[model samples]
Target: MEKKDGSIDRKYIPILVLLFMGAFIDGLDTTIVNVALPTMAMDFDVSMSNSTWIILGYVLGLAALLIPAGKACKNGRVKKFFIAGTLTLLIGSVVCGFSKEYAFMVVFRTVQGIGAAMMSAAMPSIIVRLLPPDKKGIGMAAMGGASGVALILGPTLGGFVVGVASWNWIFFINIPFGIVLVLLAMHCLPKDGVPDPSKDPTPLGAVSVFLTVGLLLVILQNYGDKDQGVELMIACSAGALVSLIVLIYSIKHDRERAIISTKMVLNRDYILLGSAFFLSTMMLTGTQYVMPYWLQISYGMSTMESGMFLTISSVAMLTIVFWVGKLVDRRGGRSSSIAAQLCRLVLCIVMIVITPPDGLLILAAAMVFLGFSQAFSGTGHTTRMIHHATPGYEDESTNFLLVINYAAAAMGAVVYSMIIAITLPETTLLEIADYTVRMTNDAVNFTAVAGIAFLVLALVLSILVPNRVPDKSGKASEASDAPDNASE
Candidate 1:
């Protein structure tokens, strides 16, 4: 399926741009609302606890729809879904901009989340399908670059926007970008047909997946919370039981047609790769969730200041991802992965040892190490997962692995939050002037928990996973020393 001129078709460039645009907006929205949460609460007269629904609503919507959206993409309705999602996002943004009540804003935010889910699911598959196998790593890098840039810039941009203008402007900003993406996508994106229904539709299997994920989130949210009353505990337990039952039933009944694709799951390589991805993301995202709060509360810094400090990690990640990609292509998965995990372990220990009152400069340096660790591990994990995927199941394999990665992230966030909520009250430090010591203690405790989890997970993954590439002697091996072809 090589194109004319011995190059990937340039026709896909516009589509990539559109997908990148969507991802950028999604990133922007996440950070923009984060800085504006206090403002939103004050304006709407809601408690901080209630205002959190703005975030939870979006996550719930995304979790509910991600797998189904992937199914839809495989069924060849990608363009339709993309356009619909764009419009929905546009409308949701407008609704959010105009919302004066907390309930109304939460509902619209959920709508935006649905759009985000559809776009996220469809975009990667489209990228993979359009690019040649040889060029896929580069293509993935480009897409990943866009996402990385958004992550690096989002909080800073959000802080600036909110500081200088009204919070409403953040939502309004997406309108122009959304319109342009939709129009370009209509012209540039190809229309794919429906997937063959004769090949195991698995509608019921999909339902079981939805239920399982929902129950998992609920359990994570309630974990370690002191207010878990008898009814809440009973409900969580029941939910876990139901999830297990549905999962077993799905495995038994749809042994061949399960939504998670049992064939992929059964592979030893895929299982290990999935586990590695899950652990890597859990550590990366947990740190991301807590770091900014740590900077702001511990150092008495503003949102903008915190973001600036955090950018050091993003810069480090950006540089390492390129090198990591090359290593994955050349050196085989095992060596790169093991090295990355070891680096992460070192960096995590460094961060934990250098507690607050160590000054922002020292913290920033630690974050740089942390960021590099994340990039190296993340890139290795993703490359390994893709390289080990069964042929013709690239979409399913990649999407499934990504879902687990995100699920791990969600769980990590909840765990970190709960740890913070519980430990802050117990810390002996008195409240400091111009600093929120309680919140700072909470973040410190959360990071410690995440770091410990990462170390154990990395050790386990190192022992379990094998390399995807062959060695120099033409023998099958996990740690190849051959160099990658740079031309690709």
Candidate 2:
């Protein structure tokens, strides 16, 4: 399948649709679970701290498997990975829906995360390989749109579902969607031969990478908890350190023949783009972790109401992504990214100064602005990263960037959790068993710290992004191959 301009055939639209669906499910699952947390805690008879692991477990699972899954895709097994991932996610969701114990639910959610990691690493690479260069921005925008729609609707949808149905519906809802996605993917996704690219084809290295990421996350989550025993902390920390060393060694040993292709990380453009994505994830995910709690605890609002307010930000994000994509295509990525970061910095300042009771409206407005800022920064930075990826390294580059993004997100969640736990007194309860939860001054402080972090990231981004045009050689060459009448 080939295009007039030597790009992949346009018939890849069906595959793009599959990816869009996958992204929508991912976004929905992330936010939708928030509304169900308290209910889950009650059902499982766990403390709020332990219950938080419901979310943390999924994230940890994703971080652990992301790099390995990316490697798999780069080894020319993308279609197979997608099919396997979708089936796994479907089964996991079913298990989660039926889980009666906290431990069982956590395990199922981890499985779901593994599915997410596989699909996430494959989607962008598929788009890059299939779409024409000129349409790259639009293709990404469509992917972004699916995410935005899910984010916008997630809270409200979850709240309503929980209110009308049972919390279990949240997981069960994925069953049908997953089935359709898998079938569509099998039919639409292109087939490629799978060859062991690395000299060491044993699965031990992949297992080691997964364990390393998981251990580090566990340590990070438990680092500052005084309630945990000293022995636990020491053990977690030691495991994390060892895992880090092993991960480094594995990467070095497989640098050339590995599916991840270490050369992708060596590129200056990839480094800058990946770092920028990491910072953005730090800010965005951190804020997401805290915001729903703030709304529910501080404002005396219903879960559905809080979700509706959060949806406003998603609406703004969707609109801004399309606009930013066009700007990146026209003017290049660096300048657009710097501009977006500047906007975010200003918004963060506005967020920090406004106190809660008097500032709820101000916070809502800030969130809307933040949505736009994130879209601009994410779209521009990601486009630039893909533009600079070496030939045949597109899958590896996409995977590396996404892994960095998810890692940052996991760190952000852990940091936010620690801040909330530390700032709030032990006697202060954010929620109780079927009892009203009250907000304390500490909750306000947590949001303020998160806002400050965003400002810092924005400042760094403004300084780092270069002002230059994208190299259009690849696109130009593809265009020259087109028939004379095909020239627009």
Candidate 3:
């Protein structure tokens, strides 16, 4: 749907809503499921460690399928993909709610993750192809806002649901929501044109890419248990290395038909923005991985209290991203991104130098800054990446964002945990003594300093982004010719 007199078309509203819902449910599932894991473990009679595979199952599916799914969308079958994805997710959610065995639940969750990968792959392309140039920021902001809402609500909502009802409601609740989203998809999404078979990626390239990402994810997720996972990590590392070698060979042999073209990977703007995203995501996830425990130990707050406090950052993030997104539309992503990194740099400094307080005042202030930095970077980096995407390579840009995001999350958690473990090897929260508290605070500060390295790198990358990049020309894929179908 095209803009009229510089305003977004009225018909695109439902499409926008559908996109928001898609991102919301995906994000909500992420946080909500984490909250319900304990309950799930008890119900399934599995150890907490084994129950984690419920989450890992989903992650593995997404990692394995993301490359293939992204390649599929490059041909512009977004509407078909969205419909099928929503249906797949719905089926997975339904089965998960009624699952009688732990193995079945993990399998169902994997099915759910495959669906999420498809939908995630399509959302940005839909925005890039369907929304007018001036309105793309708004679309991104709406999706960001939905994610923010999910982040803020997921824990609280999950707690409420599981406290009063069975953990199964978490999955069951998605059924009606999924049905509605599916109907919206059929009605609101634009139709696609004929796809070019030649544009499809080679099977070898797809498989290799999948192996690289999937094995890496496995290693990152389990690396924390050094005692139990040493062998597994080594095997996965070898597998990932071999997969990477194959991926490189395949790309060199057939750059045109590879899952990720050499041109796309080597593009100056793409690498800069992508590296910045990687660093920023790494910092955000790393700090978050350690922050809650730090808060609890240093401040003597309960788990619930710490979680509620963290929502402050989510609220701040939600509020700022929309404004930053609008700024992106009016000015450019480069400036917005620079400003965000600067804020992060300042926050990191504050965390390092400021003395730990007995009260929450300093920590609360830090959360606000953290939120602002995250919002600015998230909106700016993504919007700029889209703007700088090589004309016909917009789908690849989005796919790269998803890939780095997942990788950064896994890496951040593992890396930060290691840092904390090294710094406070003997510290325990079970003791409420002053000495233990001081040690935890020291560990947190050291982690923040490490985070600065990432933020600095992100800042450098943001600076490297050119003031302007070539805008994507008219869409090349099948999605280009279908504004009217959205109305139908």
Candidate 4:
């Protein structure tokens, strides 16, 4: 339903529910499988290395398809894709639950990942394309909150499922729940746009993107492994470079139909926003990778206790996203984004200074601020990108955003791991059983200092972000004008 004063109409509630569920399921699968990995490994008689492929398989499949799927959301039949994605995930999950072989389990997980890619690519773009300017923030907040909830609940739910039944139930649980959501989505989702053949992304463009992402992920994941051959890394690096070149050619050949649009690639504000987003994601992943080790080592806390403490951060994020949505609506994306970076700046400083035990309260405060930073920056950058996107290309812009997020996650973990490895070659973070509290603080401080450098760069970029892009006539346009009535 359309409203007069920018408030959500009653008719839109079903759509929001579907979006939230889609995001929640996609995110839930990411973490829920972790708790089941040991059980899965035992059941399948596989080594830990082999079991890791289950996670890697899904990530590779999801990351490779995200960009192509984003284009499909705009130029292809979206409703059909959404249904197909859900059904695909359902089938994969059921098969995964019933699998007698480890290889089959990994293959089906990849299938589930592809399905997730379709849903994730379409969901955020739906908010931008389908909702009004004032209402888009609310939709984004709902979607973001779903992710936060998934993060908090996934492991706990996984543990409970494994405790009571076979680990396969984790996948089995999605069956009934997914089916209901799919039916609801079919009824509530907006009608799909007509397929535009002329705007179809080229096969070469899709292949290039797939190869580039897949190779990059592989390289990042295997970078420091002694078992991984240098020749393999070199080959993958070359393949990625070639794929990037092909992508550049495809974009130049057909900017309108390329996986990534030329207008977005060339836009200064888009680049700045993207860079800031990438850096922020890196900061988050780096922190996540290191924090658990620091907590258990320095605080003398058990794994469970450390996990429970970390949950507070997600709780903070989940709580603030609801409020940040309204704040973005009132203050605008640029202002909110700048505030987000400032929050990150403070978080980094706090992490640098706060010691464990005595500074536990300060550390908790920093974690809360970290959540606030994430909510503001994540939502603000998204809205800003929507605002500055070229007219008729808002959906296409989301492809770039999702691609950057995937790349940053992979890169962040590897980059920070490398930094730590280089700094303390004598002992790894996990092997620091004999480390003093002071040594642990030094390590965390080192990471925090690195985080500060990145955050500073992001802050500068956030400051440079403009409100909107100018049209051919040199007049600036409102983001709402881009696809204001496209959904209708």
Which candidate has the highest TM-score of all?
A: 2
lDDT of 1 at 157: 70
Candidate 1 lDDT by residue in tens digits, 336-444: 6666566666556665666566655666676777667656665666666777777667787766765775566565565665566456532212222223655575456
Weakest ten-residue segment in model 2 by summed lDDT? 476-485
Candidate 4 residues 1-488, lDDT tens each?
Answer: 33668566887788788888887887678656754654666677653333456666676667778777878777756777778888888888888888888888878888998887787777766776666655676777777788778766765676577766777878876677689878987887778868988877788898897788777766765555555689999999999999999988998997777777777677777888989988877787667655655776688765445555666667778888878776655445776677777777777798877777768778888778877776887676777776666666667776667767756755665566555545553333232445567766676787778888887898889787755432323233433323331122
lDDT of 3 by residue, 29-102 (tens): 76667556645666776532244466666655665676667778768688888878878887888898888899
Q: Provide the overall lDDT of each model, using Cα atoms, as 2-decimal numbers.
A: 0.64, 0.68, 0.71, 0.71
Model 4 residue runs over 4 Å out of place are: 1-7, 31-57, 92-109, 158-176, 296-303, 354-358, 424-446, 468-488
Q: RMSD of each candidate?
A: 4.4, 4.7, 6.3, 5.3
Number of the candidate with higher lDDT, 1 or 4: 4
lDDT for model 2, please: 0.68
Off by over 4 Å in 3: 1-8, 34-57, 94-109, 165-168, 221-226, 292-304, 345-357, 421-443, 469-488
- Write down the worst ten-residue block by lDDT for model 4: 479-488
Per-residue CA lDDT of model 2 for 230-338, tens digit only, reads 8887787788778667667767776664435566777765676677667767767766766665566566566678878888778888877877766665555666566
Q: What is the lDDT, from 0 to 100, of the residue 49 in candidate 1?
A: 30
Model 1 lDDT, residue 294, Cα: 62
